[model samples]
Structure formats: structure tokens, C-alpha cells
Target chain A: MDGVHDIGGTDGLGPVGYRPEEPLFDNPWERTVFAMSFPAMASGLNLDAFRHGIEKMHPVDYLSSPYYEHWLFTMEKGLVETGLLTEEELRARTQQFLDDPSAPLPQRSDPAAAEAIVGFLRSGAPARREIDAKPAFAPGDRVLVRNLHPKGHTRLAGYLRGKRGVIDAVHGAFVFPDTHAHGLGEQPQHVYTVRFDSVEVWGPGADPRTVNHFDMWESYLVALDGDTDDRAALDR
Target chain B: MSTDHVLPVRPDYNADPTPDPVVVARVKALESLLLEKGVLASETVDRVADLYEKEVGPRNGARAVARAWTDPDFKQRLLADPVAACAELGIGGMQGEDMVVVENTDEVHNVIVCTLCSCYPWPVLGLPPNWYKYPAYRSRIVKDPRALLRGEFELDVPDEKTIKVWDSSAEVRYWVLPQQPPGTEGLSEEELVELITRDSMIGTGLPRTPDSPAGAR
Candidate 1:
């Protein structure tokens, strides 16, 4: 399930488009999608569900769609799958909007409910949670990112996979979104700041003094054996 | 949390700003359905959007940065435990959880990007700007920090100063405590907070000099 959303090291993405006067939301619909994400999650749709829904998008749709468009697509997918809204009902409503974009929505009956949802979104949800899981590695330990190409959700980028790096810091344990996204469980693990050399990631003729430090979960790494010693030496 | 092993050899990144009427209809439909079903209340969407758009923003991060600038003890605590420190100042939530504050010094310059996705410390700096999520900024920033900074933000780090790029690949978020501008020793914490622009904390730009035009943003 290698989704197209993971675009990291590949080049030719072009220049960063700078918007001098970028408004918070490009359009009114963007605001609705943005707002819906909060309550969708609050109503029991976890972060992973929302993210997984996006990953479920067809490559063409994902790439062609704009940022907020992606959100809207995934939000609808989650809502439909979770039984929050029937597909037929959603389609009918969509047709209504398509017929007239300015049509008013079926407003909330209770004002207090809106206030509570708003309050919840404003406070926000924190993913960090106390876990009994212990860290496998410590700072200064040299480890290699396991060459993994899982068919599901993962935080490990393709470029950094299989690369050796030193653990700069141990960031305690947190919810493992890879598993949590799939309704498995919060398989918490130790997350570390793994530092990789520019030369190692980009090849030689790169800045040796410079390095990339990334937060990597313990599951993505394996202790390097003597075989990796030569690469580690070159890294230094 | 996604991977791309079978993606096209060279997929083009096109950012279309124009809204798709079909998708807009779908979103509108979804909103109405959720509201009618009582799954979500009306104005809930507006409140969340407003919360990020107008309520929370870089000013929160500026306040934290300002407090750290003035109080060495607070700075130490901020670096040691960003969540606790930020929570102490009331800036801890969704994207802000497990914050890692990177300090900018004469020897080292720190910048952040989420190569896999745009993961930022939202409680502090609010939602990331569009540039942060764009393919160009995400890809180039990690590969060539010097060139990208100079070309995009007019930020030139001397060849001698080491550039460290932190990619927020995991949930842990990062924000830079940029080096305080020179000749601002007498400024109050509130003034310092005003000087801390969102870009400076992101390391794409720097704090404004006292004499350099007011309000760089």
C-alpha cells in the first residue's frame, strides 16, 4: 500500500510559491472542511482515521486535488465509513451544493452544541500520552533505519530508510500512529532524534558538516552490526 | 503516515489555487449532512477555522520566545521541556504536543520542515503557512538549506556557520528560538515578542532589526 502522498527526496518539485497576502482560508468551503476535521475527530474519528482516509485517495485524485480538496475528500470518506452519514444522503447533499454553492446548510438545532464543538476545537487534542513502553536505544547509539516498505501507514520516509544514523536524543514514548491509524491500537514506542549526514542521504559532494535530524520511532530502526561500521566511519 | 514506493518515476507537483466546484459541493454536502444528523453542530466549523485563523497564531510563539529571551531560567526550562514550558505559558495542544525547541546560535542555525508531511507546533506558531506545505519548500529546504534560505527568504548564513535542518517526520514538532537581534538589550519582553515574526521562529527569515522598517510581515 505504498501511497503517493509520501513525496520526500524526489526532485523537480519546482520553486516554493510565495503568497505575500495569503488569507487563512482561500475560500468559504475551505473553512467548512477545516472546521469539520476537528469535530469529525472529536466524534470518534481518530487522527489516523483522517490521515488513512487521505491515503485511501486515488493517486490521480490526490495529486490533482488542492490541499483543502484533499481534506474534504478524506473527511467525506471517514464520515461515510464511520456511519456518520449514509452515502446516499451525502450524495444528495453534494448535489444540492453543486446545484447552488450559496445554499444554506441544515443548521444545528441547539446553539449550546455549537459552542461545545467550538470550545473543543479551540482547546485541541494532544497526541502525547503516558506509556509503559521502554526505549530500545539511547543517545549516541549508532543505528540503521530498517529498510522498510510497508503496505500501510508509516512515518519512516523512503529516502531515510536503510540509512545509518546516530541517535541524538530520546523523546520518550508516544502513540504510534502507524498502528493507531488502522484501528489496531496505540502501539507506543520510543521516538528518537536520528541524525543523518547530508552526504549519506544525498551522496558525496554534499556538506559533511551539515546533518539532518529527524524524529524516528524505535520500530523503524535496528542496531547496526559490524558490517555497518564502514558506512558509519564515512558518515563521520 | 503514508509511503510511496510505486509512485510514478517523476510525478509533477501542481498546486492549483482555484477551488474545484465539484469538491466544493461535496464539502458543502458533507457539512449539511453532519449538521442535520446532529453529528456536529452548526458554526462548529467556523469556530475551529476562526480559532486557528484569528485566535491562535505566531503571536503565541512570540510570547514564549520573548519570555525565554528575557528569563534565562525560563529559557532553560523551555529547552529542557517545551510542552511543560509552553503549557505554563498556555501554548500546548494538538500539533504542539511533544515540542522540541531548537536554539539558534552564532555557530549553528536551525530550521524545521516535515519532509513526509507538514507537522508544525500549532499551539505555538498556529497552523503552518501554505509555503511550509508546498512541495517546493518541503523538498528543497532539506536538500540545500543554504540555497533555499537565501533564494526564498533572503537569508544568507555565512559559509562558516553550520546549518542544521530538523525534519519533523514523526509527531514531535520543532520551532527555532532565533538568536535575539543585536542592540535590543533595553527592550521589554512585550517589545521582543512583537519583534519575533513567525518566519524568524521557522528560520526561513530572521527577527527584524530595530532600525529596519517596522512590522516585517
Candidate 2:
């Protein structure tokens, strides 16, 4: 996502706006990823089914955690959820964690559980990202990235703030997100690259030696002057 | 590995998956499946993944950077018809997203960081080495721009002014047009182009010249 701020800069989502001053921690499982945990805990899940529902959640837990922190957290959570270990057992495990020489890897010497974790990890790949062989526009073509700003997980950027460029290549078309991330399922749209001139973008006093180019989605471009047919000379 | 390889040039994905086992495994599993399906070579996935930052990928934004370095009139043209202005040069799109270029200057030096999961302009600049997406770089950068850049990229700019750090989002991508190298009073187009290092071009540092070739401190 490139510089698509809310129309006229309102920070549309209200307070809790972009706070550059607040730097989140370097820990992979920083509190942010788990902010929804409270609601989840309140609205508990129906257990009593198949090796437990969280058997396959290791990948999500692990990738986003700080080193093996996920191992400690997920293990305890998993044990308690499946009734294999009670909350008191969780308490003892916590004390054991404190007493351990070093936190060891998950003892999934059990092949089925290890397999479950493996399957969970493999789920991050795209079933079909819905990308295409050809793009809406190709290299050297003139196009526009429609400037839009909506509150949600955005792929757009803010650096190319009101800037432009030419298409250097039409990287095989991928699904463009209609909402935020393509993960939660999205309406994939066509994307492209539109290059621009340095001097043209920043005023003459800017560098006089290099050109600036950037990427955009089909929705971003607004055919300036209706020069669609002339798109032939675009990438030239 | 050569020390040169450590200076944060583009990264080789073969050895640069995100530092998370699960994430790496998931990606690997998918790549393996893609290979089995004959959709890609077993190594082809590694090679294509390298395009994320290794070979100075998309950079459809380079024309804007080049134009910024070249024609003043074109600069104005960029402000108005950036996409069209880019078409005039011969740079195009990558990642299916339209391209846009931003300029960083003396008053305002722009450095882009994807505070959320390394969303970079891979089409033009190249794959973002693993470290760029590291938590150390991402979490601290926006708050203490000078510190993160200094620690990671070895850039030690003064605290006299607040550096404008632009965080590229998953929705849009960004590329920086670094200042041209110094001492090239009469360099040709190819010479100048060769001088544009992916790092400097991405706003991590300035492009190098014969005098300051390695971007030494």
C-alpha cells in the first residue's frame, strides 16, 4: 500500500491514529497480535472435539512469537484447553519453566501431534492467490494508482504521496485486496507500476539526475485526459 | 561469507527466510507443493523468492528517480502526471500495483520502512533482505529514526532535525530516489545508472561514486 491517506487527511479512524512516537516492542508476539485474546477468552470455544481445536495453531503462534516464547505460551495454553493438564498443572508447568535449565522445544515426540503442527505451519501458503499471467498494464505503460484511504489492513503506501511513475513491468497480476489483507479473504484487483520523473515530482530544485518509479493497483489510476488508446506509448 | 555481503546489500533468500521456523516452514511447504505440481522448479521458488530484494526487482519507480535526477521540466510533469510521466521513460509496474515515486531531500530525508511486515517496492529495488523486516529495525525505527538507521544501516545522521520516516503499508509500496553521487561532473547515462546502488536508491544511503565508493563512515 502506497500513500493513500484519508481524503483531506482526517486520520479517518479517529483517535489512536498513526502514533509514530509509540514504538512497539521487538518481541514477535508483541501484545498487538493478541489484542483480540480478551474477547476470545470471554467468548469461549466449545471444546470436546478432535485432538483439540488448537492442535494446528502452532505455526501462527510460533511465527509471530519471539523466539521460543510461543512454545512456552502455546504449550501451557494447549494443555489446559484439552484437559490433559489442569490449570493447577499449568501453574506447576509455569514453575517448572522458571526452574528449567533452558526452555526445551515442544516434546512432540508424538508423531501425530508433530504432524498436526506441521500441517498448521503449511497452511500459510496460498491455495490460489488468484494472481494472473498478464497484468492490467505492462512495463513502459502510463497508468494511475487511485489514491484511496480507508481504515483497515492496507497494502497501500504513503511515501509516494501524490507522486507518479511509469510501468516498468507487469509483474504477473495478483489478487488486489478490496479490504485490507488478502489473508481474511479479499477482492483481488489488478496492480501495476507507474514511473514518474524526479524533477517532475519534487519541483526543479530537486535532483536532476534520476527518475522515480512506484507500484499501484488498477483502482488507483484515473486515466488522465482519457489517453487510454495512447497507452501504447506508455511504457516507451 | 564476504564482509561485503554483510553490509546490507540485497539478500539471498536461499539463506534469508523470516527468522520464524513456522513461517519459513509454511513457505517451504508451499514451495515444495508448487514444485510437485510442476508449477515451479524446486529451486525456482528459491530464485523467485530472491526477487523480493536480491536483483533490484521492480523499481518501476526508477524512472521517477531517474527523472528526478534528470529533467527539471519532467519533475513538474511528475507532480502532475506521475504515472504518465513514468510512461515517458520506459519503467513500468511490479506486483500488480501501480507505481508512484517519492523524493527525499536535504530539508527532508525520506526513509521508507514497512512498520508492518516489510512491505517494500520489490519490483524496482529488489527483495528486502531478512534484516529489514527484523523486529529490531521495524519496532524502533519510526520512534527513533536516527537510532534504528544508525544501528542497522550504519547511518549516523544528526539529531538536529527529525527525519521524516514513511512507513509503507501492505496496501501500497514505496521506493526512494537517493541523491546522485558526487564528483561525477561528466558521467554518462550508463555510468550514472551503474552508480545507483539498490540501497541508496531505496533511501537507505546515498549512491556511491569513485571517491566514496563503499559508502564508508
TM-score of chain B of each: 0.90, 0.68
Measured by C-alpha RMSD in angstroms, how accurate is candidate 2? Answer: 15.4
| lDDT against the true structure, each candidate | 0.79, 0.43
lDDT of 1 by residue, A1-236 (tens): 46766766657666677664577777787788877777777777888778778878897776555677777877777777777777788888888888888898776766677678766654656566777767889888888887777788788887787788899999888788889887889878888999998898888877665778888888888887566674554343
TM-score of each: 0.91, 0.44
Q: Which stretches of candidate 1 lie over 4 Å from their true place?
A: A225-236, B1-18, B214-217
Q: What lDDT tens digits, residue by residue, belong to model 1 across residues B57-122?
A: 999999999999899999999999998898888777778767899999999999999876668888
**DockQ of predictions, in order shown:** 0.48, 0.05
In Å, residue B32's CA in model 1 sits off its true spot by 0.5
Interface Cα root-mean-square deviation for all models: 2.9, 14.8
Cα displacement (angstroms), candidate 1, residue A114, comes to 3.1
Each prediction's RMSD over C-alphas, in Å, is 5.0, 15.4
